[model samples]
Target chain A: MTHKKNTKAIKLVTMIMLTSVAQAQVTINQKLTASIYSDNKNGVEGDDGYKLIEERLEIRGNGQNIEAYARIDLTKFIDAPSSDYRDDERLERLLTSYHLGDWRIDIGDIHLEMGRGIALSLKPIESAGVDTALRGGQMAYQSKKIEFNIFGGEANPANLDTLSQKHVVDTPDRIIGIRGQIQANKALPTIGIFGIYLKPDDQKLNELLNAEKEDQNITTGITIQAREILNTFDIYIEGDYQKRRLIDQEETGKAIYSTIDLTIKETIILIEGIYLNGFEQRGSPHTATDTRVSYNRPPTLERIDQEVLETRDILGGRIRLERPIISEDYVGHINGMYRIQSPDSEEEITQIHGYAGLEIYLPDKLAFSGGYRDERYSGGALKGEKLKSMIHGEGDLTVGLEGYELHAQSTNELRRRPSDGDSGGEKRYARGSTLLGLERGGRMGLTLEYGYDTEKEGVRQHFFAGIAHWKFLEGQKLRLAAGTQRGGVKCIAGICREYPAFAGARFEWLGHF
Target chain B: MKYTLLAALLLSLSAPQSRADERPLAPEIKGKSTQDELINVADYKGKTTIILFWATWCAPCKKAIPEFIKIQEEIGEDKIQIIAINMDDAQTRSRVKSTIKRNKWKMPIILDTDGTIAKKINSTNSAPYTVVIDKQGKIAYSEEGYTSDNAEKWAERLKKLSTEP
Candidate 1:
């Protein structure tokens, strides 16, 4: 089934290319980039290195009344000598758009924004591995005074392979959604309404897990963004609401998320809140599905239902200010934020963070900067009350003279998270961590960085990073960077995954014709 | 030949090290500034000019302004000139100033506002950009995003620039 889908996509792309070829007025431009990374460590045996590479191609075209773009990433990886990296797969994004007078049509992987808020973002994290590329279509129309747009697509889960590995399901489950917006007077204010219908394709999964049928997951929301322009001062406000459906038998569950943002000169303030009253989906269990010896492995669907019922709510806000102390040569800024999350069953968590920094310029093309951040997080989980706090400070200085430049930075961090009553499941934070780096650039630039991190009672981490960007010929560039991160869980965004002590290196070359 | 080499060495040695003294004036634009002004490194003067590089899509820059405002307030007006350079493309130029006004920014902002200047400045294709020009027209400092400690150091640099002849 997947193969058939791939073939269909290829045919569609080819047909589009051919059609554009026939139309002499329409021009199509294409570009491709490839990158690879490898790794090796000291204590580890075997090759100790894995090579991952990706090739991306994009085609774009624009004419008097039409414009469109499409991109795809073809991925390949070499297995670690000791462990097989066999599950890697290739992914593609194809978007085609057409403009007819004031109306426009778009098909394939689509992203949409309503008002000032991002209502539909398929790829939330491009670097940290979370790629939620929605596959669907959209249509929009605009006039001199107003603009309207409607979009619908399928939501591909982040970890779909977890379910596929257990059963022979050819097609992963999907979530479908639709959104609309209206913008009046491109200068003044715009209001938008958006709604989505997420239906899980669980036909095979229901049979495999012996679960009952479920209704379509539904989400609907609205946003209001207004901007008031005065002679000397401007005021803008943006707010949004989003609701998600939680299915537990006939139990109806919903989650609402909203954000309000305001800005003044070098100052900006934002307040965001979220409340979950229904079921939310947690991550996959560590043990495989077949491991049911003493205690029954929690059913995946049931676990999802429980998560939705847990009722999680969060409220947060951030404020920032920046100003020039000495003309354009020097500037300073300060930022602070506070967040609190409360779960229906677990202890509520509260965090407060603040940071201050400054930059300076010297007469000899030398620049230096330093800053510090203090953060504290305290909360309780299913086990007992817990508290964690950290204070981190860092400074960097760079000197650029003649044809060469040198840059270095260092960070010192202290973290502490201790449990009150629970000893077995208690969490311990890093007592101290430090990072240092230096880089020099000229005809051939070189960078070297080292880091050492120690936890109160957990793991100690050591990291080394090096990179070189070399100019081979005129207009041609070659870059090589290698780094090793030992111990601790590596994370992107807030999501985390554990990898054994590993070292990695990447090399790439680029040239334009 | 000996005289020419000596002149060359002297010229290289005498090249102004400060961005303020070295930066040339905004050249005569054969055309008007109908929001299409090109922003190369040559348009600024006198004080160390800190350009706040920003884009409409950058959340961090948007959230870091309060700190920037406080720093500006503490630094006073005569010591420095803050130019908020918007990186919005030409298509979004119409909304640039209005957005600034709506955000209540008091700083004088040029429209690089169209992103042309950002591309020329070798920005990292990211928003919340901050670039510092020395008194002699040289790029003294540049960074993406805002942090408190960096803000302090930026102020310190401005102070240093003030004392330099």
Candidate 2:
């Protein structure tokens, strides 16, 4: 009887193994970038010879129910501006996830978002090497009508902020959050509720902020959304409340974000509003190096060209309209916004902004698009003496030339401010860039670019660069760039990443296997 | 002159004729369309699929998407499936549906809210990246940025993959 039972179990195990083997598949994706540079930055981090080599590789593996990702970096400097021989190699990111029926569990680095990034948002934006991801664990469940996630982790901001070429050592905060959603019937459609609790390490807080205001914050929010209403309109609204417990005091805050998009007779209209009263979520309040890292990024409700504005005290909104011009190929739009910012402070300011753009698609594989924007800020009343103003324009043109294609791009922006010395002619500052390139299929590409800025500190005002791109194999490309590049503030969404200027000859090879 | 000739010859090895035979599997994509419909990449595997990563602020993407729409209309949807994944960040995400409607985009749209899809596929966190996966769930062609003149080339690649066994 024992032998018979064992034989039956063995047969069942063999059959299951065979089935698993039949459905098994594995795939790996990788990205490797190599940079060789020799720079002449005048007085900057210039190299005498081209001996500084940096390599970064990101690899991801996927199976039927599992995924793993990692990023590794290597830097080698033999002899540079000074006599230094250093070789560094380390792993930057490691993430893994497993998928089970109706459940997914993730460990290592991860990104999370809730209700348009009001409650939580941690992601990457590539400009000059400023990308932030959380090092934590998350468990999510999804079914037909319900979804929820339980996430907790520590913050791991990017180590290097390329703009300053300085390492960022941030206080790692322990964050825990829960978000759940359900799809109710037709009228109420979707409802979501979320709560996030953040605790900053006391040691790091004391070291950075002088041992006085160790903040522990708790945030709870709710979002309600309705889509496809009458087949023409969609609306969404979110409300947030914050309870801050500081070492010396306790403070409470509230915020609201909302948007409505309406489509009627081939034209689309949108209205958005945000009211933030001291409810901003910061991952690290103050780093050792005097930088602030944020976890939640609420909508700015304005153009991104503006510098990162203070969301601690503000009430603003915008309205936009877009329609087709001659045909669907030609599109046009106009946008305007008004806001009173920094109301709690003595020097409050009111801002008004306007923007217009058009897209034109012509015959013979030709397309042209352009946009112009004007923004004004007043210290007292609407249409009063302007505290500052900005005007910007950009254009893009693409045309087919025989067997090759030509791409031309240009951008210019001018900023003016009230003259402080009385002899200043509006104190004008401007920046502009242009590029022209030609490409043929996947074989070859050649490009030339020029950029100039009037207010670039610690770097040259003019930038001239030439590049050649050659593509081959499955997913590989080699590019060579030789010239000077001026670095400045690159703002995305509501955050800005400053990059360092460069004047060098660099070769880069990018590929995946 | 000799070194230049040698370098040029070696670089030319990556031409179409010497392309690699192995195809990397495409990353998983699951999101909700602007119409609030669930869009999953796994469900559509029997035909060639073209996935376009785009955003509103990216002017080139605006140009590339329309040309792709014309291609799909001419090629017939029965043979190919094209899904445009919007990579708009949280601030600009609300404008996607309206942008599509105003532009008269005749394609299925998906939202990458936290940029999870773009990251999984190594999109460099930028816009106008295009990817093509054949019926076997393998990446057949990929391009980082788009140019207007490459429309015909993209059409040729898609049509060829659609007919492959």
Candidate 3:
């Protein structure tokens, strides 16, 4: 199909879907955000004096046993189109589903994730820019003991932003998958098996700079998973085998992941492990790792940057324990992990990390917490070899008064590394922050943070003012904040993203109709 | 950035539509619990019930569960019941089971891996969603998100709901 024709068809379908959804009793949730940045120095790379706006609209409705949802996002730069503007403004997601007696059918962008996302996952990772929406249809059947799912369609292009910027690609890659599970007997474990096949189309026009064409392969994989929850323990295991073939090269990958959680009284112990051989992890490269033929990642693997997934051969395990130290009010935790990785045609890297922490809760008035961490990494290539052995030790303390209304925290870190060429020394860092407001006394407050690095003799300071109103105007939640801070990694849940230094303002308002 | 003004205008046009009369009856949901037993929501029709849709990976859900537990304790089981419907997919089922057990929540929980029940209630695609059903089997309140002090508000609402004829 021609590009213009395809675009017109998509627009027509979108409008029809929107009109149908708007007629129903629907609720529209809208978010509008604008950020202004100004940085004189080059300290904050890729960010200059500019303004960016992001607009999001989500509509949801249910009628006649069918549910519908749509999200439209538009992002634009002020004045002129920034280099990145080409990647802005796209129909993010559209979905409609209906259920029959024992069967369900879903069409349009499907963002489904299966068993820990090992074999096939249509889950989008925003930070990593890993896209996984299938613009297709799914059929599912459920019974007392057996369930089946079959889906086929084009997977959202891996490089959505790049494709948006260029807009020359004709067809997205095709994806087909089938999954089934059987209870068989209630006394036995529930077992599931899934298989997926993917074939990239027209790679010549849709070239990606960061990805190697050799990496583009017709990939297929199958996964088997089992789960059993004993009286005191919960155990899960999954094994995956994938095969990829290019015109010249063919490779097979295998991975095994498992987790066991044992609960005894008030204490919890968890053991998780992963082993990979020639498995190039799949997700979004923007997501802190590599991308592969299949959209699968050992979602339970723990590492700083998914570094373990970067290697061709990898093995890792982690253990964590939580228990009461002395009484019901005091709790302690200990965790440790070790990993070894060998990147394809590269040197092997080994890492070991551990941490211990304790928290004491005082009856509704005050609380205190302290923690210690030790991290070490070694091995790699020449320049990376000099990057060789590096060790980091850190400690933190936090005290809260009146249930965190008045809170203060301090963190200190010491790092030791082998001298590169001439510089042979250790680095020390100390950081502190204070939060001054709770919901009761003040609707607005101030936050102050400072960080000092001894080796670089750099001092970073940030001051933020925030205000939150729960019942603003008409039962709306409005939160506003303005701040200036240094660039660093921001983490939510276990996902982390590195952001540039910024001085900006943020406003949020949430209301439902 | 000119779209900012357009977005703001769109936001201003939204009118607060009354929703109490439009809510459909709760779907009949029956699922296996982490304890390996069947739990049916319809069985609790005679008592005020709060069904909180949650997941183990959601930070807010983790925060809200403990508070819901406290609220359940204050309201007492006879006056009201709180059921947590887990929305984690099958891959994370084990994690969900372990997390609930470790927290020692006293409320009954149902595993809804397919999310059929949650979809019937509301399709916001998130955790920490809450629905309060009155003793007469009508939805009194349904909220899509959570705040720090929502538990106190829920307790107040439950107390008021318990007194309703």
Fnat for each model: 0.00, 0.36, 0.04
Residue A205 in candidate 1, Cα distance off native in Å: 6.0
Q: What TM-score would chain B of candidate 1 score versus the native chain B?
A: 0.65
DockQ list for all candidates: 0.03, 0.27, 0.23
> Candidate 3 lDDT, tens digit per residue, A1-513?
433443345445544654554444455665666666655232534456666666566655544446565666676666433454433665566667676666778776675555565555555444433455677778987666777789877655433332112122224566677887776777666677777776665444334443344334333333333344556666767777778654435788777778788878788887888777876533222311322334554453442322222434678787878787788556676777777665343555666666666655452323333333333334434324333232333333323234234434444444444544556654444333344444432223234544433322332344343434444433244565566544454333234444454566656565545
lDDT of 2 at B58: 78
**Candidate 2 Cα misplacement greater than 4 A, ranges:** A1-52, A77-87, A202-214, A285-289, A363-386, A419-425, A456-459, B1-22
What's the count of clashing pairs in each model shown?
65, 3, 3
lDDT tens digits, residue span B29-84, model 2: 77767766667777789878889999877767877887887887788888788899
Interface RMSD of 2: 7.4
Q: Against the true structure, what is each candidate's TM-score? A: 0.60, 0.84, 0.77
- The candidate, 2 or 3, that scores higher on lDDT is 2
Query: What DockQ would candidate 1 receive versus the native complex?
Result: 0.03
Q: Show pairs that collide, candidate 2.
A: A163-A498, A163-A499, A163-A500
| Residue B165 of model 3, lDDT score | 72
Per-residue lDDT tens digits of candidate 1, residues A1-513? 543474357438633642452232221111222323343343335534455554443333333344334433344546534322333332344555565655777666554333222223332333333334445667766544445566655533332122111111222334344544455454654555666554544444445665565534444556554444452233333333334332434444344444333445543333344444442322212232221111001011110101111123444444445555666345465656555555333555655666666655442122233233232334444333335555666555555444444555564555555664547454544422233322232236676767665552233356777777765653255677677644444433233333344466667664311
* Cα lDDT listed for each candidate: 0.43, 0.69, 0.56
- What is the total number of backbone clashes in candidate 1? 65
**Order of candidates by lDDT, top first?**
2, 3, 1
